[model samples]
Target: MNKQQKIIIISIVALTALLAWVVLKPVQPSDTATTTTPHEAASEHAHDHSYDHSYDHAQAGDTHDDEDVVTLSDAQAASAGIVLDMVKPAHIFTMLTLPGEIRFNQDRTAHIVPRVDGIVEAVTVDLGQQVKKGQVLAVLASTGVSELRSDALAAQKRLSMAKTIYAREKELWEDKISAEQDYLQAQQDLQEAEIAAQNTTQKLHALGAGTSAKGGLNRYELRAPFDGMIVERHLSLGESVQANANVMTLADLSSVWAEIVVSAKDLGTVKVGSSVTVKASAFESQSSGVVSYVGSLLGEQTRTATARVTLPNPDLAWRPGLFVNVEIVAGEANVPMAVTTEALQTVEDREVVFVQTAEGFRAMPVKTGRSDGKMVEIVEGLQAGAAYVTKGSFTLKSELGKSAAEHTH
Candidate 1:
């Protein structure tokens, strides 16, 4: 072989043997493992062990002084609707709130009726129309009224004739120009006519037909008995109504009754002449009234007694059927320091108020006295002139809870 050919063969064999040796070598566990140098390994160990020693120390002392404190800026407080008010001396009332409804005052209300049977001829007043006392309400044509008026007229004629006859008889008796028996008979006749005339005239007057009918004898004018509003009407033109029929209803709304239900237990709380404050549920209105009536017997179904408070309804503001709350001032107290009821919160079994501080607010524990559902008397743990949250105190309570949880974690 040539020298060049010999060298080529030797090189090819060396390369093939080297590849075979590598394929035959065994794989050790160290080869399968991920490679990391001593520096890289130290870096990893340090990373896994790294932690905030200061945070660990802080967590050990979890009960921080500001733990119950909620920090917020002025803008944040305003946005969250956090309202603050000063604690001050105030009066607290112990009240009993009972549901009630406004009703028409029965004493001032009347059911108007045509006194005699009649056919309606003219209706001057209508439903909801205001009327004055003695104003004509309606006109009716009644044959009954006409008969009474006719009897009255006939009685008047007879009375005139009897007067003349009696005068002549009296003169004759005095002059001794007539027999005594004849004069006595004329006097008896005159006396009987006078009695009949008086009776018929009164009967006509009782029917509200008056002493005389100018144009129509059957015409009857029904007049209002008081100044009021017509609440109901049943008679119309050409309608026939009976004497006792409830043809109309008039109500004097100058006064109204606030009727309340009192349970058996509360009967002792309410009494006649006790003053109460009434608040309307349908509108923002408040009024004061005195208890006027209390039913003696309880209702069969409800087992409650009905009580009434009289309220003067000037301007017709206290309308009938409006739901109301009658707040009876059962007791009152004057406290040196008080806060609104909403300012109090139950936190960790403690009654607390979020008192304003230079660093936001802190939940201040309080000892409370009398509470009237509106304001509570802070007997201890808070001083007057200190500002505290009045509204939106719940938000401060939540923030305090969160702070506690974070410290625990």
Candidate 2:
């Protein structure tokens, strides 16, 4: 019994000691915590790297912006036909462009008419036919012409009779073979006949009819007054034309008129003797002329004044009724910086000119002043001697727009 009790007591005390040691021992961290901390740190490093990558990308985008440029190889430029020019001083004219129409020069235009009533026997000219001065346009059978010739012939015969009688009487009186009254009467008759003849000749001259040697007294000829192109024809064969009937219209096409209707505001700008450029709309012909007339009266219906430019159309290119543009140069100004008008482009509501740079051409905005169609005055944002695109600047503008769109994206 003693041995058994001692063994049992020893076992119980050993079990209690094991339990106390187990309860009093300090706690240690788990392997899962170590593994989780490392995973979190790796995630944080990856996030920081991603942020750095985005920052670098933003910096690169800023660099691109600082140099808003376009680069084209020499071959590409040549193929595009890009022309470059340097800024220089030039005279730019301020011009006022107005709509106009080509018209017959009224000063050199004529409406041919038969002075006496007649029947048109033949029409020698047609519409659009060119004729020289004194060229017969048509022939007529005129009764009035016949009467004029008859009167002239009668007067000539009477003058011949009076001359013979006067000669005989003068000879008799000088020889003292005739009375003084008879000689005086003969002299008075001769004077009367001369007066009648002169009156008849003047009347025939006024009628534009000369005594016909061919005995066709009624023959009347309508002739051209000047060298001109026939623009209109009214008389035909066998047509009866009255006195003062306009048979044909002839216009000197060598010179034409550019009739411009100017507004009241622009009346002062367009004055007589001012130089003008006339451009035909139907064709690519331009001529320079002087303003010959500026009407004092404005049209009541149109409320505009008529201005005329006498253009020499030696080639007959400026036909009547053709539309035209009249550019009146008001004045000229000397500018320090100027460029071709083709070089100027409107971008973002600003006038821009592509300037040559080390890398490429950069679109630069500019302020402009006076301008003719050929050249324009660059008031600001451009310096003399700076190279710029002249002929093909529009292509650069399109390129710039594309670049801007890409940037926005």
Candidate 3:
């Protein structure tokens, strides 16, 4: 072969070998599977803020990435405390929520007044003290009570003296040792003394005073009429009070009144004996009560009427002046589709419920209406007969959040 021909052949042979090596080299296995993290999935699912939509506007036959879905087996779901239920028609209540306040039950509250004028000698009970019926609240010294007792004592003395004279006169008359007129005169005197004594004793009784006092005739003890807590104390040591002046306030706190502010338009729905639910404004506490009162006259300025619900406070959790929300059921509604209030959760600032799917559960955005605190009406986004997570939806939410974080990382 010629030198030029050989050189060309060798170059061609090297080029061909290089091309073969590039084409036939062993292929290292590349990652074949594609995965969607929850974060990416949620971003893809994000939609307009409208509450009216069906299935997030996704078309039928759309398949979701398994990684994007929240998958839990029956055993796994049970272990994670997840519960599922089908969305269906349910009966819901139309609740009228109104602002209210906890207050002392007036029927069981008392404005204490010392019935007689007196100087406070000893104050036994303090504010907020629990007192039993007939417990002495304070001690007082009253000249009026003393005067009544003194008058009673003098009358008794006269009666004793008259009795001695009348007995002798009667005996003398029976023996015919004295004139009938003299005996009759003695008897008249005795009757006058007895009447005077009885009058003074009755006056003492009227004063709630014993005929005699142990410390002094003026000594008096003010007592409670019923079991209650002393809410207010207006009198101090040595303070003199009038007969009718209010000295203290006692309230039976075993029960309380929830006073509701109802506008004129709401009066018709707030009837006496209607059931009510009271929720605390500042804390997570709720109670049940009945409509004990509804005012007929509205406030001239506010155009609102006062309504009351009597609630039993066995634990004494409800206190006067606590703000509360009073929920009164005005009517009922049967919605085509409803889910539990607890099932609803917020995602991307939109309300969503975890819906069950063959792959797993998907957080589906929904529009809701008219919740009675138990069942909430599904207005849009969710179709009837679809199964969704109810009790443990919060757990599913956490899972979604973690998936989103993983994608972020």
Candidate 4:
């Protein structure tokens, strides 16, 4: 309870009062105010702007999907060289093309046979040699021809004698130099001789032999019946050939036949007298012909019917055994809308044609029908007079592919 104790107590009391004043003091407004920096203010403003812009872009992205529009400037379009066409009505013919073979016209072809058995003395023509009608193809030595010609010669001599006897008998009868019975007998003999001679002459004529004074009796000439080419020759010098044996095959190559192997399904369409176009495979020449024949029965092995078309082969271009394609016009159809075949394309396993739009081109799905190789009938998804891309539609397809890829990403 001294002065030191009182000093310590005063210090403690002062400290406690100071702490209490600090704890109990009211919070007054700061003299140095809290202020934001320019960089911080800019950062907050940028965040708000980014949020609003993202929302606006999200709204715009939805429009992009609904409008699958491709925009190309005039310069770009010109550079791409896009070709546009308008759909129109056209005649689209359904055609059936069949494979065929060129063959000889059997109607004008001949298998020459010797009528009488003989040895082939000479063959004047070779295979593939062209000859005119009445041209001798070969000379044959035949005993039968010889006998016929001998008979004709004897008949000629007898006929001359008969004429002499008939004149003498008539003169005798008129002058009364011989008895009436004797003259009548001579007249009868002359008549009988004349009849026998005529009979022999007719036999020779039937055998195509004559009493020619120049050649030997056994000589027989084989001549061409018509102007034709010798496609086959089985005759040789001094070779014996039997009667009715085919010695030569002559063909009048002025005309040929297109043997078309038509499937059974096409039997109803391919008819006789219908026109068809035949295209040769070896060359670029095409010929038109009429279907001359259509077999009623199908071949057992081939399961196809045979149809024939006769074509004139003046130039001999339609050679036998040459392969050909015959396009028969089955029928024709008039369609309301048609487009060029070049405009058609396959996209996503769908047949599509690029239809022109105000903004750009759109790949429009379509259903196609009869096609005549040049024009195609549009069955669905297109209207007449609508603009479509014909030549350069592939470019638009590529552009569409790029857009789809971007959307997928």
Error of 2 at 386 (Å): 1.0
Model 2 lDDT tens row, 1-409: 6899999999999999999999998766785455557788999899999999999999998866544566788987787779999999998888999999999999999988788999989899889999999898998899988888888899889999999999999999999999989999999999999999899888767766677646388998888888999999998899999998888899999998999999999998999999899988887889999999999998899999998998888888898999999999877889899999999998789898888898898878899988998999988999899999997888888887888787778
Task: Encode model 1's per-residue lDDT on 50-166: one tens digit a residue.
Answer: 656666767766656478789999898999899989999999998999999999999999998888998989999879999999999999999998888888889889888988988
**Runs in model 3 lying further than 4 Å from the true structure:** 1-68, 73-76, 155-206
Candidate numbers, best TM-score first, in rank order: 2, 3, 1, 4
Native-to-model Cα distance after best TM-score fit, residue 254 in candidate 4, in Å: 0.8
Judge candidate 2 at residue 109 and give its lDDT. Answer: 96
Over 4 Å off, model 1: 1-86, 339-375, 379-381, 387-409
Q: In model 2, where do residues sit more than 4 Å from their true spots? A: 1-84, 331-334, 345-369, 379-381, 389-409
Output the lDDT of residue 238, model 1.
94
lDDT tens per residue, model 4, 1-409 = 9999999999999999999999998866673355678998899899999999999999888766434455667787678777889999998888899999999999999998888889988999999999999898998898988887777778778778877877887898899897788778777877887888888778766655566735788888888889989999998999999878999999999999999998999998899999899999888999999999999988899899999999999989899999999999888989899999989988778898888787677778899999977899999989889998898777767777788788778
Model 2: worst 10 consecutive residues (lDDT sum): 62-71
Q: In model 2, how large is the Cα lDDT of residue 35?
A: 59
Clashing pairs in 1: none
> Candidate 4 regions off by >4 Å?
1-87, 171-210, 300-303, 339-368, 378-409
Best by TM-score: 2
Candidate 4 at 293: error in angstroms?
2.5
**TM-score of every candidate:** 0.69, 0.75, 0.74, 0.63
Identify the superior model by TM-score, candidate 1 or candidate 2: 2
Candidate 4 all-Cα RMSD:
8.5
What's model 4's TM-score?
0.63
lDDT measured at residue 234 in model 4 versus the true structure, 0 to 100: 90
